[model samples]
Target: MATQNPPVADIETAQISSQTAQAGSTTGSWANGAFQKLKSNLVFRSKWAELNGAMGDLGTFIPIILALTLARDLNLGTTLIFVGIYNFITGAIYGVPMPVQPMKSIAAEALSDTNFGVPEIMAAGILTGGILLVLGVTGLMQLAYRLIPLSVVRGIQLAQGLSFALTAVKYVKQKQNLPKSKALGDRPWFGLDGLVLAIVCLCFIVIVNGAGENLRRGCGAAREGSDQRDEDGDVEGRKSKTARVRKIIFSLPSAFIIFVLGVVLAFIRRPKVVHEIKFGPSSMEVVKISRHQWKRGFIKGTIPQLPLSILNSVIAVVKLSSDLFPGKEFTATSLSVTVGLMNLVGTWFGAMPCCHGAGGLAGQYKFGGRSGACVALLGVAKFVLGLVLGSSLAHILNQFPVGLLGVLLLFAGIELAMAARDMNTLEDAFVTLMVTAISLVGSSAALGFLCGMIIFVILSLRGWTKDKPFSTIWTDRSTPEQP
Candidate 1:
């Protein structure tokens, strides 16, 4: 009897041959299987990895950065609770798992303009959330999407990224004790401490990447050799080796090592740190609001926030739709409606205002947030955190050094900056850069967005005027028509 190839093998072979012919690259089922397994492990089983990765992404970084920046202005206790709540809601709606804290731009404005106390703000948040819920239920959120233009929306996001990067640098400078140094008549450069921190963080990132690469190479080598032995023996041996290696690596507790090193370095240097960094409260404290106070404050606070929240939602949808669904007829109205509803539901349970967070949603998609289920997982994590340890979360976040936060944020900003470069035209790129610059200079994301929009409008109007029928009379006959 002639030996025949198994049906599965035949199908796989055909697929591989087709792909190889089309792309000049060979792929095997074994490799696909390994990748699928690794992906599954990273997403489903590895909570720490998921958390860290989410936090490291722009979505988490933006809120955390904001939190750190506005630490002095806002109540640490209230902010922590707000973050947990916000994260829970955004994670659910956007299908991106990450914490959303107080937006520094909004917080600063609130601090300056709103006389409402922390309790009142919390109440207002509750009301704003209710409004969102009503809008969502009524399906009005979708309508909001139609109102905003993609260019303006993205202009704001790009501006936000610039703002974040500039703020990170500022924070780093402050922490490093770098001065304007006008007295010395020397051009400003990185302070001694800032330079040291930057070098250390860079080294840490490089080391981590190197270690990961080495592990991957080792795994590949082991896989290549596994077929030499009896099929079953080879598989079992390979599995054992993989498990052992993974176990050793995972059990090493690298975070502990970094912490130890930091402690040791601090003790040895005893250098006078320029800025006093406060991470969070020493302990979690839950302050209960009376029913009367909650009711009165909620009404007073929420009414003002509704417009801002709506504006935020509209801006977010426009930007997201532009990049994710470019050239497609994305209904801004529909997105706004969806987000509005999500916000309403989220706020009822003490969540923060839910809008389309540019960084979180974008980062989640970048990190493989493909479906609602993935976003649901993020929501679940946030919900759990909020319900179980809302207050204490602040304290935990506070423990991270400003330098580390700055480094993480800097990386996130760089990622956004790179993404901005994908714009099709120089005009768009200029708009993005200019918006970012204004936002950073003013130290306000919202204001930066407003300025960018103003510029966009002015340019758009100019283009319209030039395109008018009468303008043709003044143009040279030899000049080609403008697109």
Candidate 2:
């Protein structure tokens, strides 16, 4: 009997596996070989760009962490330690600025209830992690990745980015009686992280980001239609005044600067933070879970996060990674396995449950992170903080300006939404838009995903009414135009 060819998706998966194995086999130790591969790659450059990019996801990261630590009494030191290791490992393997973030649904449920403590959080993480591991190990994640339409993925990205932008705008805009906010509406506009400082920070980040893109475009344009000799010539005019200005701007590391300023302001606001700081690591222990706690955690946290994790964490992250770094490809199975392993290993010690996020990836890319070094640098910082200040780091983070985070989140959100720009067809665009609208209005990505899949199936069946086969309808939209 003639053997049938495995599907294209299968072939792609096989290629990824082979490449990784080849890379790992190069050295005596697999770990060393992977690191050696990363060392030889230019995309892993550690520079000011990495510094700026490292802070890109912090806008979303800090708030959720603060909420988890301050609200639920989770072991902050242990969380950072594991997340730090995860960052470096993810950066090393992926060769891009992959992000590890707290599960939003889990964070929300954990924060809203006073009764939801560390044990429940750990239970939820274990359950979610176990399911993801099974999905990845059994190859079900790869199958799901192939089946989900690209339009639906774009919709998820667009909706998430817009939602973040909206939330950021709210953070910028001050309201009376909201003392928990970083900036007060009643304060002097020019005083301490109020509207004026927020606007200034926003302007600086926008200018740096815009100027860098312009310089890159100019260089690309100069290289176009050039002879071999001309191409060899310095296209970016190293000595030019304009080039110097662009270099200086990029070197400023706006996100890092903003973050440091926030920390300073936090210290100023709460001088007692210095005295309260204990110079040691927080103890790590497996949170004891009751049978009731497991059920409650699963129902309250895992169930809400399951669809979000499936759609955003695994599928969307894989899709977005490919789009952002065309030279690099990521597998949904790999991402699922990593996320699953992260929570299973860490949450036992009361660490926050984490996963890959598209919004975080977009944020890093927007902030000049073209390489894995950006995340690795961030990992180093987290590692140091965990070892030194530990949970006391939360003291400063608690007072970290909400307005600043809002500014950062605003840009990250917009950046994530821009990933949907590749949509070239009307029906596909409409489907993406409708899904985004439903997600934002209904306040649920799962709803958007369910509706998107249903709408996609219905729209896809249009050709079937004319006696078209299912494969024709599937293939027509399955191979979307690449940007």
For candidate 2, write residues 1-483 as lDDT tens digits: 999989999999999999998877764486776667778543545476777888889988887888778767878898899899999888877878899899888888877776778888889989999999999999999999999999999999999999899878877776322222233454346666688989999999876666334233212122122223333465763345554555566457778889999989999878898988999899878789999999989999899898889999999999998887889888989999999999889888888999989999988887767777778888889988998999989888877777898899999999899889888998799899999999999989999999999999888776455656665766766789888
Report the Cα lDDT for candidate 1.
Answer: 0.47
Give each model's whole-structure lDDT.
Answer: 0.47, 0.82
TM-score versus the correct structure, for each prediction:
0.55, 0.83
Off by over 4 Å in 2: 1-35, 41-43, 175-188, 211-243, 466-483
Cα misplacement distance, residue 249 of candidate 2 (Å): 2.2
What digit string (tens of lDDT, one per residue) describes model 1 on residues 9-74?
Answer: 889999998987766433466667666644542343233334334444432443343343244233
Q: Ten residues in a row with the worst lDDT in model 2?
A: 217-226
State which candidate has the highest lDDT. 2
TM-score of 2: 0.83
- RMSD to native, candidate 1: 14.6
